[model samples]
Every structure is written in structure tokens, then in C-alpha cells.
Target: MSTTTTAVINLDVPGPTISRHVYGHFAEHLGRCIYGGFWVGEDSDIPNEGGIRLDVVEALRALSIPNLRWPGGCFADDYHWRDGVGPREDRPRMVNSHWGDVVEDNSFGTHEFMKLCELLGAEPYVNGNVGSGTVREMSEWVEYLTRGDDSPMASLRREHGQDEPWKVPFFGIGNEAWGCGGNMDAQHYASLARQYGTYVRNHGENQVYKIAAGANVDDYTWTETLMKALSCLGCSRTPNNFFQGLSLHYYTHTGPWEDKGDATSFTREEYYLTMKRAARIEELVRGHAAIMDCYDPERTVGLIVDEWGTWWNVEEGTNPGFLYQQNTLRDALVATVHFDVFHAFADRVAMANIAQTVNVLQAMILTDPDSGALVLTPTYHVFEMNTGHHDAQQLPVHLKGDLPTREVEGSALNLLSASASTKGDTALVSLSNLDAEGPRTVVLDLRGRAVSAFSARLLGASDIQAHNTPEVPDAVAPVLHTGIRTHALGLEVDLPAHSYVTVSLELAP
Candidate 1:
């Protein structure tokens, strides 16, 4: 029997506009993500633009990725901006102690990254080195990237051939300061964040949105400490001038961190567990937001989920430290659910960047090592399908009646997750069915607007473990869904198990 769920979308009463930056991506200096993934060298046979991978850029651009975070997850702490600029050949090589202990040839440095951003039309979100770097070094890097005048750092940028200063809209203070970035306590890191963020000045109209690293999974104390320290009471001074956002890092793993389940070989139990973990982001966001409300009630300080997505065991024969994993139907569902959560709390979550893009954990495009062939993963299709929601006014979705549920670990998990947003005259409603073995029916009770017609697209596979590969790239791709029908209230959608669907409505005036 197919379970049915009802949702009422209030279109006229629109909520906060979902920031397009929420659909952002992360590219770290780990494994093939930067080396063979995005940068194949100007001399290599792969198609590239000034050493930046053109295909990867084109694929990401198609999804309209708003921003790209560069350099490191942990590597940002050890990185020095000077080593990556000047001349590519003369740039110094350093060891990537964070990922596989691999030696990084300074070929893809600051200039190459900014150039890559330009090609993809994505705003640069550079993570500054704060763990091991001095304040002076961090300060100059900002001047080098955003200074338009002939300042010392800006002059050096011109010396490297970039005549104009590049715009950096987003800047991360550090990553995982509680763990990898630096093992600092909450209070200690909060103080350091204010200190480091102080010097990350705005140079020549390039105002950077500084995001300080916040808590891990459920450490509300870290968020509280940062909020209390950064928030000013009864004073004219505000928090945004110093730092505008706080960062949260969370990953959906099937099992314990010591033994993250295989991406394609997960059991039914593990699949549900992964979904349960993915759904917990709502709790984390609410908890952190509550703390922020106590401090900055105006919601000036944005919550940035800078590091997210699934983290499964590395594929066979791959380097363990690389954090490589296959993207399956399960992973795509995870992505959809996360987007729904982001939209529900659009007023709080200003931005979110999926962990690492390309050949890493929950990547969009996976490249073949031998032939350099590119394969678009299932998760990529989800992002491409939901592009309509970017910067759109969020429509409040109220789910009514008994919802479908799956039991896991003595608790019930809602099998249906949904969110809707409107841009112009069109509205996009995204739905996810988390059940692994049965179909589900969703009847959207559209309100405040009349819909003349609608179209739908679906991304799913016969099995939850199905994924894309070089030989069969479209194995889990999206296709136009014909199972939608006009309902008495609005419309009815039949969703397959472990699937994601997006409906586009032609609203009537």
C-alpha cells in the first residue's frame, strides 16, 4: 500500500528569500578534488582553461553554483598565500598533512583559484589560515585579493598578471577549529575568531562576510560562547561589522566514524540510519538559532553550514585519507532533504557549502583516473533540478494529516520531506521519499494562488545503491515524470521509494 501525505503551501504569504549562496560548493586541497579533479595542469591532455578544469566548471555553472570555498578544510590552517602566488613554477611545494600526506605542487595557487571562480561565474569564498598563520599574513592575503589601489599586496597581485582586484564575497575564518583546523575550546576559539576576523578588512568595496567556525554536531555551548562573546549589548556597535556569520560542520555517516559504511554496499538498516542523520540538521540548526536569538535577536549573524554531505568509506583501491565515496540514490535523497531543511529555515541559514566537490565525499562530478572521463553523480541531478529555488521567496509548507513513518532505533522517521519556493510567476516544490521499498503519494494543497498547469521531473533508480559511473553516467539521472495529476485541491504526485522529485507550476493570475 502506498502511503499518502498532504501539504498546504501558502504562496501569498512568502517568507524569507532563500539565499542562492545556500546552493554553494566546497573545493578543498585534498586528494583529486584540487589536483586531478579540478586542476589537471595546463600541459595535461584534459580540457582546461589556464590549468582549471573546464568540464567541471561548466557542469557546476549549469547548476548556477553561487560560491566556491577554496584551499582547505584543514589545509587552510597550514596554507600560506605567498607560496601560491607570483609564478607557478617558482611557487613552493608543501605537504598536505590533512589529506593522504600528499605533496602539493604550488601549481594551483591563489591566481588559479580566482581564475577558476571567474570561469564558473561563482563568487570566491576563501578560507583564511588561522590555526598556524599569523594575523599579519592573514591580513595581507585579504589586501592582496580585494585591494583595488596600488597597495603593497595589490601591487603584487598586478605583478602576477591579474590587473584588477577579484571580489571575495565570502570568507571563512577557519575550518573545524574544534577538531582538524585546531583543537581549541569554544571560549578560546571565539576570542581568536574576533581577533582574526578583526583584520579581515574590507578593501576597495569588497566587503567580505566573515564566518567564524562554530560547533560540531550538537555542541550548543560552542555556539553560545561565540554568540555571547561576539554580541554587543546596549551599544551602538553590532556584530556584523566584526563577523557576520558562524560555521557548522556536519556529515551524514551510516555507521560510526571509525567504520563509515560503504557508499554502495549499505544495508537497509544503514540506509535508514543515514537518512536519520541527515534529518538531524533541523535540530542542530534550531538549537544554534535559539542561542543566536538570545544574543543577536535581529538575526544579523548568519548560520553557515560550510561543511556537510555524506561521508562514507573510500572506494576500493582509493587513498583512505582522500575521503572519496560514490554518490548513490541514497546520497541524492540526502541532498534533497538538506535543501528542504535549508528552505524551512531560510531566515536563519544564510549559506551552505557541500563538504568537497569533485571526486571527494558526496561529489557532483567524478572523473576517471585513466581516461579523464567525467561522470555526473546522482546528487548532481538533484542540485540541477532544484536550481529554480535559488534566491526565490520561500513558500511556507504546512503538512497536515497522518504522515508516513519508518521505524529506526526506537524512533519514527518521517518518510516524506518537502519544501516549496516561488520565483516570479512560477513555483517550485521539491519532494523526497525516503522509504526504500515502497511508493508514496503526496497531494499538495496549493493555496493563495491558482495553478493552470504543472510539470514534474524525477531522479531515482530501481535500487537505492544504484549510482553513476564512467561507462553508465546516466544510471541515476533525472527524467520528466508523468505521474502527476490534477487533484481536487491542487495536484497529486506519485513518488517512488528513495527518490527526489521537483514540480514546476504555471500559476494563474
Candidate 2:
């Protein structure tokens, strides 16, 4: 392979507006992500708030998580609201069947999840069961959570012990209807979405955001079908809206689910493929957004990428059905790059939640429930470091050189990824070098803005396989460097290979 290098000291491109929800995360009942990860039951010795672990709550609060999707990927479609309400002993118990086939006690229902969202100060985007649920079932769920008066569902909520409604505004019609949810075609699912969404009421103060199940990856036809169907509904001379947002799910993996690449060990080949998959999210969003444009020129409906993140084989000796994976510096770069790309298309991409928030897949925080110890993963650091990008205006940056590329299958991805935002007199630049080896010299020309000083916090590891364990917690943490000098036309910094760095520049007086 031939070596490649690129340099552009000062190039300007318009920054995209960043959405607050892009920093959102997901927690499903599928694994320890909920049972042992975020919720350990109030009776346990662990510190908790109404059964939710206090430590987990504090950690997530620190991330400023804006939204959290719950109940599941496939579990949502199988879920029945009635079974998760009323007395615990009376609440029905059903086999997860889709996940580990473990029996679910329905202890954590609508009330518990809404309360958890309140504690985290996040908007609760509940995935309503549509594939296997009747329209009345979903409509009652909306009424139960949002109705304030003595309506049938509101009476049931009061009878269940929670008198006040929980004001949940975002609702997903189903999850992955093309596969796990029901395996329905785009045209068929579109009609089903219209019927189910029609009855979801926005009771007082809550302007419900109903989201339809979207395409998996690059299935543009799904977006086309949804947008066309919704457009037809909008002009049907009816007084109701079918849906507000469309959802898409994508995971970065190298092989089939059964033979996914190792989480902690990989050759340069594997590293390249992972980043390549991560970079494809940009194209996926753009392609889907383009279809939405053709069918709905008014941009009436939004795009919600509610499920996305790395999906690898389970850790050694861990429950294979749990989908647990170790978090490494590679995961941090993936998070940073993915967030930057999402920010670039903020107008169309209204909200996105990482696949699993904790203890499963590419989690931000992991816990040792047995010991009650919490570990912040590399992905967590990336979120903490880039949190400044939340609600920040995306500033455009131009690049002129041919950077190195990582090849996968037959496609190649640029090794350098970057996003810039300016708030007040401070300009923040986030850059990621996805190459597996060798440092990349980045020439950031900040002549127009008059930068006085520059500093950065970088996250990298000696090897792509390096990860954080309970014993080696600092294996991959951000290293802060201060008092950087700027000379000539711009600033030049050596970005470590396979690293994510955030540079903050102070504007000259």
C-alpha cells in the first residue's frame, strides 16, 4: 500500500447546526442494559432512585443525554402495555422469546421508565409495539401516559398508583418492521403505520412526535414509501397526522452476527473495515434524506436514527445472547466520527440514539453489578469531550489534500474526519484519525477568525485492540494538552493515529 498525506491550513465550509438529541442514547430490556445495568431494583444494596441505580443515573446525567429510547429493538413490537401495568404480582409475565427466552416479570413498566427519564432530564422516546399490537393497544398506551383527566386510560393510570400523566412526547410506531418487528414490505408497513399512528393522541401540553419504522441501512425505498404515504395522508382532507418522524437503524460490524469480529483484538484489516462501516452512516443519512425530499418537499416529516452503534461478538465467557462487547479507543473514534457526521445533517436528522447505553454492544458506561463498581467506556469519554458540540452551530471547514483511505469490501473511507463549531469567540474543532498506525499531521488554518491560542484533549491507545478493564481503567482516557501556540497563518498539530481529538481555540482580541 502506498503512503498518502494531505494538508489544508485554512479552508472554509459552512458548519451544520447540531441537534441536542444527537447526543441521546438507548437502553433496551434485551440484556443487562436495563436489569443489571441501569436498573437493579430499589431493594438491592446498590444506591437507587425508585429501582433505577443512582450511580447509573448520575453517570448518564453527566453526559447531558437529551433523549433515551426504551423497551427495545425487537422487544417493542412484542410488548403489550397492559401486561406491564397494575400490581406487580398481577402484572403478566411473558418469555422474552426474541432475546434469551428469559421470563420477564413486567416490574419496570411505563411509570418506571417515565420516572427514569425525568431523573435524567431527558425526553422519553417510547417505541410503541405495532407489529403484534392492535391499534387500540397503542392508542391506550398514549392515553395512559399523556391524558390528564379522568378518561378511561387516565383512570387506569390513577388506579395503577400514578395519578398524573407522564407527558411522553416522542413515540416510535415499531422497530425494524422489515426484519425483527414483523418483516413487512415498505408499502405494507406504510399503511400499517398510518392506521396505528392515526389514533395516537396528543393530550394537553404534549405535542406527540410519532415516528414510523424506517429502513435498516441504505434501503432508500423504505424512505420513499414512507414519505409518499405520509404525503398522501397529509392531502387526504383528514384532520389527523400519520407520523412526524421516520426511524432508521444501523450497526457497524465486520461479519455476520454469529461470527462478528472480536471486540478487543483485531488486525489492521479489521480496524479499517470497522471505520469504513462507521463512515457509511453519512451516506446512509444523505441517501434517505434525499428520498424524503422528493416525496415531501415541505419537510413535514423528520428522520430519526434511533438505533446505531458498533455490534460485535460478545466478550469472552459473557452471555452470547446479551450482545456485550468491550469498549476500546476504536469505539471512541467511532462515536466521535459518527456524531460529527450526524451533526452535518442536523436539519434532516432530528434525533439519534446509540444502540445500547450500557453493558451491551458499544456502550457508553459499563457496570460490575456484582461489585457495584461503574466504569466509563472509551465511548463515554468521546461524548464527554464533544458535549460542547451539543446545540452548537456547525461551522464549515474546507479540505484540499488527498488523505489516506481505509479500504473495505471494495469501498474506501477517508482516514481523516473533522467537524468545527464556533460559539461566542471560542472555536471548537473535533477531528478523528481513523488510521490504525502512524500519526497524521493536521494543519488547521484559522486566519480569518484570529485565533490567539489552541489546546486539545486526545483519546488514543497503543493498539487498536487496547481496551478498558476493571483492573486497567485508564487504558484509554483523554489526555489534555494546554498552552498551545499558534504561528504564521494557522495552527499545526500532530494528531495521533487511530485517535479522536478536540481542539479549542481562543479568538484573538
Query: Model 1, residue 124: what's the lDDT?
Result: 92
Among all windows of 10 consecutive residues in model 1, the one with the lowest summed lDDT is 232-241
Error at 486, model 2, angstroms: 0.8
lDDT of 1: 0.90
Model 2's alpha-carbon lDDT is 0.82
> Per-prediction TM-score, please?
0.98, 0.93
Best by TM-score: 1
The parts of candidate 1 lying over 4 Å away from their true place are: 232-237
Q: Give the whole-model CA lDDT for all candidates, comma-separated.
A: 0.90, 0.82
Provide the clash count, candidate 2. 6
